[model samples]
Target chain A: MKLFQDKISSAASRVRIALALKGLDVEREAIGILGPDALNRKPEYLQLNPQGLVPALLTDEGVLLTQSLAIIEYLDERYPEPPLLPGKLEDRAFARTVALAIAADIHPLLPPRVTAHLGMIGVKAEDIAEWSRHWIRVGLTAVEELLARRQTGQYVAGDAPSMADICLFPQAINAERAGLPLDQWPRIAAVVARLREIPAFADNGPAPRS
Target chain B: MKLFQDKISSAASRVRIALALKGLDVEREAIGILGPDALNRKPEYLQLNPQGLVPALLTDEGVLLTQSLAIIEYLDERYPEPPLLPGKLEDRAFARTVALAIAADIHPLLPPRVTAHLGMIGVKAEDIAEWSRHWIRVGLTAVEELLARRQTGQYVAGDAPSMADICLFPQAINAERAGLPLDQWPRIAAVVARLREIPAFADNGPAPRS
Candidate 1:
């Protein structure tokens, strides 16, 4: 079993946190996703993950899993100890909503926004950042409302650290790094503060972009 | 089960197709996501889906499920006869690779690109369209490569339709509606052609923007 790629990938970090929670150990190979090493570009790596994305988890059964949510869900399904998803079906969906709010909505917008920042081509950095903030604000505002509905708790989904917390912590870090202020969403700020206190989260930390 | 207000919502359409596949009857309410139906504006819808996106499925148990992929997966899990995800665990992951390529990569860029075309905002329409095309082209190119590697009959995974096909068919219809060209990816084009013949896909159709 192997987790191929780097410490800096949001997707990779997600797997790491989940695996730690499950107490499962897989061989870790920190291959560079970009540049000369470009593990994602290698024929063998591409075979494992055709999309050429990072944090591709090769399961003990030798099945390579792409997409953070899918991989995480598979792990939770296979290993029930210290479950990541909530117990009830509705609660599970709610956790998924919080997770997707960041994974699908906030995560995708970051790259183009950053690419625009490089200004290597004609795309303006400010425009990209503006686009990034627009989506982040939209998603985070919704997350704030979600957290508000749940009683004052330790994580995004009630007291326990569920998939919602796992998905959100990294995105919150990324949003902070992107210079998007969280002053507007106090509930989210509270959640982030709580998540930061966890040892696993602090250990995984945010990746330093190349 | 009721599908919350959406006269013309692609997400809603996708779920409608899932229900049809299961032969389950569901009542529909057109809350009009973009209009002043107030469902999307009210706290109720916000509670259901923090993203404020359309096609929030109100289950028989009254749980509101959001995020089309997540909702669809739930449906597939519940109704296993006409499976959405097919083949072994590895093959299922491959199918998810195709699904994410459309859902996360291609779909996210569409709204901004389409709005960019309207020229109502100051942001360059051409730039937005270029960004849309760039992401779509990259996604489709990957799909094309995946197909080139293994395609048994008409469908993506094997002879039968899977979640990957379900996701791709809808997006293909959407891209065509948006006037995006498909000459570049023949394998994808072929798959789309084959999927259109399926009853489940044909009946749901693309939701028209009201």
Candidate 2:
């Protein structure tokens, strides 16, 4: 197995955390996503993943999987020792609801590509920052309420760190990067603090592109 | 079962299609999403779903499932008669990848809330329209390429209309609403045409709020 990834991508980081938790090993290749040498835009990489996004997983059978949530689900099913979701059906749905809220609602608004597009269309930098901060606050506040309403244990979904935490850890990091105080969502802060103590998540924090 | 939904929501429509495909019956409640009576923001509705989003599913067990993809997944797992995902693991992953690409990547950018944020930040109406069109085109173009490379049958993932088609159909409707020519991505256009023949997909087309 191999993973095409960029170190700075939160989406890629979600998969990295999953791989660690599952104790699965895969060859890693970093694909540049910024600047003139952005390899993700090249013909060869485009052939591999037409989305030009990082974190595409090449399975042993040579099937390529894109989308961080999809890749992580593939991993959980393929290696079920440490399940990323809870056992009960309702719990599983709750875990996924949190994951989708972050992956779909919040993170997409703050990605570099989206911000860059805003810039191209003449959105000033300060306004863009405000835009990022606004969404981070709105989305996380909802998540904070969700955790308070549904949390059964130390984590977002239950006693263990499941798919919800896998999504939350990275998004909390993103909120901090955007200059929002993590404590604004205390439940999220506590959960993220707990998650950081786990090596799988700690090791995957945003790093300088190598 | 009961569904809290707004007729015009594409996200809500995704769940509606899944419910129809699964042959399940549920009581329906239309929650206003626009105008002064926006019930989604009402205290009771927010208590049901802190995110205040439409298309929340109240299960027989009284577990309220939010997020269209998550709710559909829960339905698929609970009622396995007409499987919404494929049987094979790889095919399942592929199906989810296409679903996520639309649910997470494309749909979020075009939603009313996001566009409202852009307007609040001083993006001109024309620029906002361009923004909507640009993202719809970029995202569907990627979906088009992905389908060309991986489609094994008439549907997005297989001969059967699975989760991929469920996500695709409403998104295709959303694209058409944005005034971009659907034929710009011929593969998507074709798959959507095929999907429309299914009553599950056709019945869920965007409707005016009653």
Best by TM-score: 2
> Against the hidden reference, what TM-scores do the models get?
0.85, 0.96
- First chain TM-score for all predictions: 0.87, 0.95
Interface RMSD of 2: 0.9
List candidate 2 stretches off by more than 4 Å: A36-42, A208-210, B36-41, B208-210
Q: Write down the lDDT of every candidate, Cα atoms only.
A: 0.70, 0.88
Please name the candidate that would achieve the greatest lDDT relative to the true structure: 2
A121-161, model 1: which lDDT tens digit per residue? 35455655666666677778878876776434677777888
lDDT of 1 by residue, B1-210 (tens): 787646455656677777777777778766545544444456765656665676778788866777777677777766677787765666677777667767666676565323442243354656555655666677778778767765556788777777778778777776666567666688788887877787888888667664
